[model samples]
Target: MRTADTEPEPASDHDGQHFVVRLLDAWYVACQSRQLRQRPISRRIFNTPIVLFRGSDGRPAALLDRCAHRNAPLSLGTCQDGALECPYHGWLFGTDGGCQGIPALCGSQPGRGHRVPRFETQEQQGFVWVYARADVEPKTTPFVFPHVDEPAYATVRYQATSPGTLHANLENILDVPHTAYLHRGLFRGVERNKVTATVRRFAKHAEAEFVGEPVPKGLLGRILAPRGGTVVHFDRFVLPSIAQVDYALGENHVIATTALTPTRDDEVVLNSVITFKTVMPRILIQPLLVPIGKRVLAQDRAMLKAQLQRIQDFGKEQFVSTEVDLLGPHIWRLLRQAARNVPEPQETTPDLPAVFENTVELMA
Candidate 1:
């Protein structure tokens, strides 16, 4: 097997075309994690096997899982001297993935040719991200929640290994109109309030701000929103990943935040942390709201899990989209462009690809 350095990296563009290549560059994905078990945790990207290990520094690191000696799984071995000692013959490898110790031969080294591949690792925000592409510097900061990370904040994590394409789920979460039907009791009210809204697009961003609300009804409107007054719902979708809808509940009062992450193509981990920036005592708010916030997530899971199964059976070719599914189409186009070997133009460059209209306009 080729060493990490020897392996040729996938270039952003074989031609001069620039597309957003997400997988190649190293990205700081998490900020917090308790140690996992001593055993290796298996992960696959599109189906390639990898093993995650905690080095002697008590930090998380990953390897190709295959040992260099005879391709024995290094994870099958035990951790000694801060490295994995091969169970088969006691060949130990360092965090850099080079064979460091050969037990039976005390004075002899395994030599320079013996090494395993190392993957770039960072633990932030409570998760892990592996860079599968090559020749790119990391452009993203560690995953963070500025408000939640502060003192006097209480947060909870919900991790579920969901099934189905992440693209479908991202669009579903961002599609506000569907809640009137798909999530009748949870997200939106059963009654349809007629409000006309316009969608304006500019350079990879779009927003639908709701106005003239004869007012929305149901649980959120009742308990969370201002009583007998107009409330504005501004749903914003930040580039690459992140969607947040802030319902104006008076000055500086925001109702919710939902972060949907693609753990894999067929699975996603949706972590919803709902907090109010109030000086209220923890005893008062913790008991009153934590259960309700978790219940909101449970409501989504019941519906989405069923939808996922149905889609997997039908496969990708049969799914249909209406005018509301525009955002999803753009997401797919971008992902495909990345897979087809396109490089991304820097934020400073405004050059347009011939396949796209202008960098500023949405291709209609």
Candidate 2:
């Protein structure tokens, strides 16, 4: 793992090459833990095909989708006795990707070197994470969804694919200004309120804390903060690809954490886990929240698809952001730096000042 102050190796000048190289070194969410069962399932990350299945112990395992013998897809096979059996030749592979049995040999021992490439995998918070690089060990754990499985907290999970770049999708989730327009009555209205946001940028993370904000007036907002006392809001971004939005109103609190997994240059998968602690029972809260949350996500997905189509038609992006676009520029910078494998300054001590800090007024 590279440290904050360490110098990066010479990276390719080509943006696409840099993107592939840098992103392959990190861990990405492959699928929900419940999705993987007795049969093999296929997924793609960074355009690389992968197969996921459960071992005999019921633990998740990930491997390159191709079979070592004839390049057939392992996902087309079946799982028997904790080993993946190739459909073409009935070869058996263990969780570690080592070929354990060869039906053709009739009880003969398989060669030690015959195996498929396997990636590191772990199950956390009901999601299965797979490290992209097969040889390199993961330096950090998967991002934890806040307040999940905690007492008095109602959780809802959502998954969707957006036709946008990773950066664009992340920025859309962490951007606040769009909520007032794109989300309109469903999430936030076109109401104008002068709120001060203190933006802070760090090496691998960025956050904006808002003050003097009024309670939201949208449909969901009305349901969240009906009494409308004081509202404490925050939007944060974690490096490589995670965004979190937190809202606190006295005893009521809501947190939405989204993790982005890029499948291609123009396609990305969003896995969002929302946890809220309010004066409502889980049974009632979940039933009411799922539809509203789905609507909000659908709105964002349509907007991103249109945005991506416009950019494609124009042959490039021509975005002009203002000061109110708090986390967009910061997220872009961090992603670019990460793509180049360049390290920024880390927060060494609690008293250390932020790399960049500013207060801006915006209407929510």
Candidate 3:
């Protein structure tokens, strides 16, 4: 099998165009690992149709969904002998996307070599990621959910699709003040709090930390912070659309990371994994945790949908960022740099601030 470095000639799709070529080169989560079984499942990322399936050896394979001959969707066909069979003409395509057998031709070779685009796919951290570029490898491995595999931590995973830009979702996850108002009774703080936050930015990453915040009074606090103390909250934005938020309540900590992948310009697939190290046993508290987490996610989804609709109608974004919107600017800086395959200079407007602190006042 050829490595991702050896790309086939670009697919005839619009993605081959120069304008979007760079964006397509980056790796994006195509679907959850559990979703692809022996039978094929079709999904589209960056507007490229892909059919994902597991070969007889149990490794995942991704192929352009269109059949080489009739352009029939290979996903509608069946998997046999470790290859996908085109239902329309009974043509079999091997894992490498090369046409192998044609029923009509019987032992005779089908003239004119043909193959569909096969994308580079890797499965890690419970998700399947694909590089849309016909012949490029991802610069790094998929984002790691370190706690998920750790024996000491218990993790709960949640997924949803939001009708918003990936940047919008990233901003929402890292925004702290919204928790009080948007998640009033669930994860918000009750009293007006004066919080001190520091935002630090580096070459390809950024983070914000909030200090002197009171223990959350919402359901999350009830379960994870039964014995209250100061809560130290931190938010970070990793390159290529990943947000990590951690809340430390004394010795117990609640950490969640959300990885966002753009399915389209206005739609993003979000995978959120929340892990906790608490006094209570994980198996005992897992059930309660999922519902509360879901409640919070639902609220975020509603707000994002409303925000997307407004942007769609207005045809532009003109929102203002304040001192509290510390993560937003840095997120854009790194993401835009990565998209352009450019490295952010050590000094520039919105340059990585080694460390910067501010005070934000909010009425919960």
Task: Single out the weakest 10-residue window by summed lDDT for candidate 3.
Answer: 1-10
Error of 2 at 35 (Å): 0.7
lDDT of 3 by residue, 54-121 (tens): 78787888899999999999999999978898889988888777887888885747545788788888
Weakest lDDT window of 10 consecutive positions for candidate 1 = 355-364
Which candidate has the highest lDDT of all? Answer: 2
lDDT of each: 0.54, 0.82, 0.76
Candidate 1 vs candidate 2: the lDDT winner is: 2
lDDT of 2 by residue, 265-303 (tens): 778888989999887555666777789888888898899
- Decreasing TM-score order of the candidates: 2, 3, 1
**lDDT of model 2 at residue 272?**
89
Each candidate: how many clashes? 11, 0, 1
Judged by lDDT against the true structure, how good is candidate 3? 0.76
Quote the RMSD, in angstroms, for model 1. 8.8
- State the lDDT at 52 in candidate 2: 96
Select the stronger candidate by TM-score from 1 and 3.
3
Candidate 1, residue 206: how far the Cα is off, in Å:
5.2
Question: Using TM-score as the measure, which candidate wins?
Answer: 2
Which stretches of candidate 1 lie above 4 Å from their native place? Answer: 1-32, 35-40, 70-73, 104-108, 134-137, 151-154, 196-208, 212-216, 226-228, 236-241, 255-264, 278-299, 341-364
